[model samples]
Target chain A: MAVLPNAGADALLMTPTPLADWLVVAPAVLPLLVGAFLIIVRKRLHWQAPVAITTLALVSLASIALLARVWSEGTLVMTMGRWLPPFGISFTVDLLGALFAVANSLIALGCAISASRRVIRSSRRYGYFAFLVLTAAGVNGTFTTGDIFNMYVWFEVFLISSFGLLVVGSTRAQLDGTMKYGVLNLIGTTLFLIATGLLYGIVGTLNMADIMRKLPLIEAAPLMTLATLYLLAFGMKAAAFPVHAWLPASYHTPENATSAYFGGVLTKVGVYALFRVLVMMFPVQLLELQTVVAWVAGSTMMLGALGALAQNDLRRMVGFQVILGVGVMMAGLAIGSAPGLAGGIFYALHSMVAISAAYLLVGVIERRSGSASLNALGGLWKDVPLLGAIAFVLVLSLGGLPPGSGLWPKVMLVQAALEAGRGWLTAAVLVSSLLSVIALGRFFLLTFWRPSSTESRSKHDGTPRVLGVLTVVAIVMGLYPEPFVAAAVRASDGLLDPAAYINAVFGEQG
Target chain B: MKTLIFRTVAPYLTALMLLFSVFILLRGHNEPGGGFIGGLIAASAFAIYGIAFGVPATRRAMWFHPIAIAGTGLLIAALSGLTGLFSGTPLLTGVWTKSPIIGFDISNVIIFDIGVYLVVAGAVSSIALALESTEDNH
Candidate 1:
């Protein structure tokens, strides 16, 4: 309960009483079990769409409650079966898990709702729903799992489900996308498995808490060796620079709704896992190995923006730009200082919402206009004021313009980089943001600013509900980032102190 | 003549293999076999069935595509883990209380194993079926 009272859990264990700690666990998992049941049962029900939608709405509610609990309290951990630390599997809730679960699930529900009516139009719609839930479940598992091996397993669960979703329709393009997605990620998975095995061999335990506790005692060489493998694996998953071939290869393959879900949740899992393992378990090297990370992140951000600029396809351009955001966010972690980590965390939450909104707008734009290619598309700003407004908000936020949530994170990261005396990072952020603006703005201007040509596909407006969902998220998050900021700070605190995590697993800090 | 006989029994054999896969999943936590191996075994059975009966029949018998089954399996396994999160236990925490009833042994953590069983079985067979279909098309 509340990080085991920050004392010896032995004192806390004598009571075995329920607290807010138990509350956090329910939200992380409850709706998934219920959702699965509802989905399957809905198969037999007459009104399957409503049933599935309502179930996800319930899940969204559960995540909101959890975020509230985690925000009010710092972090929550539950030891299974009344067992003390070091003996039983522990499930933990920190700011990172809480924020991601709430925001991602909400966005997930929005994405699901946006496409629910149309999904069943496909014969494989049930499979798609199943994949969606599995993907969400895998992401939840990835964020909440406290064991290192379990995290690897969860990543596979997410990846495999995503692979299926990518090839849901099995067209030639889908196969090409799935092949790229599956092979690159498979390599990442292989490295992760080998690294996990090596870490387990060195540490004698796979539980993250056990490892974090024992890390201070072990030889550093093996740790660093495994860390490099892990960083590469996770970096590839996050689509950081050169290793990001798979992302652009497949990010545009799936239907827009599917792409929206991927945009909203999948890559963010890589980001969350990187933060969880690198920050939570490997603080010593995180500080020492900061340079390699910072440079990699800087390069990833710049390259991603450049890649986006080269794309003429709306979805592909957004996909490339999403990679740039990954580097910027990870750079915050590379800083390893408090402000930097918080900035990174804040940036992650901000980008997930901003990117999801952008993807949703793109989908609706294409749905109404009949093509997502910039070369074949022309302005709808004249005809569709609503889409234009959504585009304005999304682009402004993506470019990290002021008065948007993006600006706050960029500001925080700049400060963190400056504090770390990597003054070049401040300049890097400026240059990267400037490039991102140009990259993003050019697409927007060409698509929305200019008038539609004679052969242009007619622009269709997004449903009120779809536009309403993302608009509310963008506005609320942009206007009030305090809650998100607080969650990030708490999550940062939870990660920095390995004592609670270590004690929960090993029964003692020593 | 021999090939005809193998073809004739293959469909039934697929059923038997799936049942055996269930056996492995049930016994896995206490023994050497579990979902992954069991699922693979079941998949191979389907592959054998696919060879005998053709890809379409095999997929038709299974009811969904190979990838869909894998996706569903993953979803089920993940859901089983999520059960702990909702119940106020830790995520992925296996919760079971063993009770001895003169001759009966049952713990619903066994149900969790069944979910894993389905996942593994579904994933392996579907992959087998999908590969078969791709080959057939060529």
Candidate 2:
């Protein structure tokens, strides 16, 4: 656990410390400490939810503060052991990372609140809160770390916690889901490890900024191989085409809140890594593989939407839509242009909030109507008008309809593709959006508009309040997108140009 | 497995191994032995004791759930890294003593290693005990 580099007393006296430095590591460290604490206090059912919620709320605040600092001051670097960059394990938060961290923490906070109902006493005894906080720590660590190997470590941390959460109830379906999820994800991480090892061997450093500075001096052939390996690995993690089976298969087996958390945060980590490594470290190689990636993006989008259209289970439909979202982001990466990357990042932020809310709404529907299958559910709009309105808002955002968070990014992506003269990619985006609308629209109409298929039992629930807030946030983002758009454009600029990132690590010292 | 002769010897063997594991864990700062290997040795000792006696006896002997031990160890490990903060250094920085205390080097580094030792031993013992109990049931 102690990855501290060698140092004497003299090294500590050189650099003056600041409050912002502590804030940079707060998102990762606070959750880990609180998670361990939760494990110790797992028996106190009353304490677990409150502690976890408070910690996540604190994490959200810290991440927002860090984001503000990074937005204004470029990148914030906090080197462990007081060692300088390239030697120490640096927690570097650039604008892209900071933005994602803010979103990650807020979504995690929402998920934790939802888990209050979703996680039962039996599951709580199994350390659900511990695993949840630890997963957040892993995601935050992945976002903040500048070292490539450290990112792999964070992946393991989260994946292990996810495994625990997946099999919390020891149900047969969950066990089967975990088996598939574990095997495929392990393969992906192994590939990532192999790629990291090779990149380290070639560049002689694992620090991303250092790699960026060194990769230009290396031969192009090996770099191309590395880029392809990364694409395959992160693509699998992001649940992109041909490697996305694990997501749809395993996601629906877990508890609804757990599923919501997974939907919100997990694949986006892969997308973030792709942005950091491909766009930042291997831009030339990424460009070389643009056509291949565009093909993958187009197919992933179409197949995911088509798969969603074929699903009757509500969460499973959203599961496929998760894949569809990944394909949209990949389209941005494949476009390899400024607007394209911005659109992808913006869409990612939008989806993290929208999709999580969608899953939570599904949970509420399941709890109220006692069914997750669309065929067995009907007339929610008449019975629960408020929930139907929330669902409508989520559908609008998720389907990229007007006046929702999801539309602006799709427009930017389509416009970027058109501007780049990729008419086929443009058509793919439009066609997939149309298909997604049909798929989700059918779900909304059947579940909300059609006559009741069965007697409904309504109960007092807290989920709508949570769902209402998220939908409102999504609506506000749609109604007022200027700030979000500016952040995305600036974040994409940081990715395309890493001079600020590099200097923040190498130059921000005594 | 619980034959009289084996059970008679098991207690002595387990005690010696536990003692040796402590020795290994203590000398890990500048030597070949460390928390991970030391923890493995200690866990094997517990596993032998569990095999000789029943899992219930072993659980009574430990007197704490292995997972709780592991969690405590994790908390200790995370907290140990904060020692650097007092000295105005970044987290996880090794804060060493100016001189050996009682002819032994004492630092947060050793505390961190001991935390690792507790985690490994606790986690391994739990897994082994669970497997043993399952076998007994079968």
Using TM-score as the measure, the top candidate is 2
Runs in model 1 deviating more than 4 A are: A1-28, A31-48, A80-84, A123-126, A455-464, A503-510, B1-31, B34-102, B130-138
Interface RMSD of each: 8.4, 5.5
| Model 1 lDDT per residue over A6-74, tens place | 346463344443444555555445545544554444344335456546756776787777767767664
What lDDT score goes with residue A481 in model 1?
77
Q: List the residue pairs that clash in candidate 1.
A: A86-A505, A368-A460, B66-B126
Candidate 2 CAPRI grade: medium
TM-score of each: 0.87, 0.97
DockQ per candidate? 0.23, 0.51
Question: B-chain TM-score, every candidate?
Answer: 0.78, 0.94
For residues A1-510, write the lDDT of model 2, one tens digit per residue: 223335564443347566557888899999999998998888999899999999999999999999988888788888886766687888899988998999989988988888886688999999998999999999999999999999999999899898988889889999999999999999999999999999988989888889888899887448899999999999999999999989988999998889988998899999999999999999999989999999999999999899999999999999988999999999999998999999999999999999999999999999889898988999899888989988998999999998888999999999999999999999999999999999999999999999997777776676467778889999988989999999999999999999988888888441
Off by over 4 Å in 2: A1-13, A508-510, B99-101
Give the number of the best model, judged by lDDT. Answer: 2
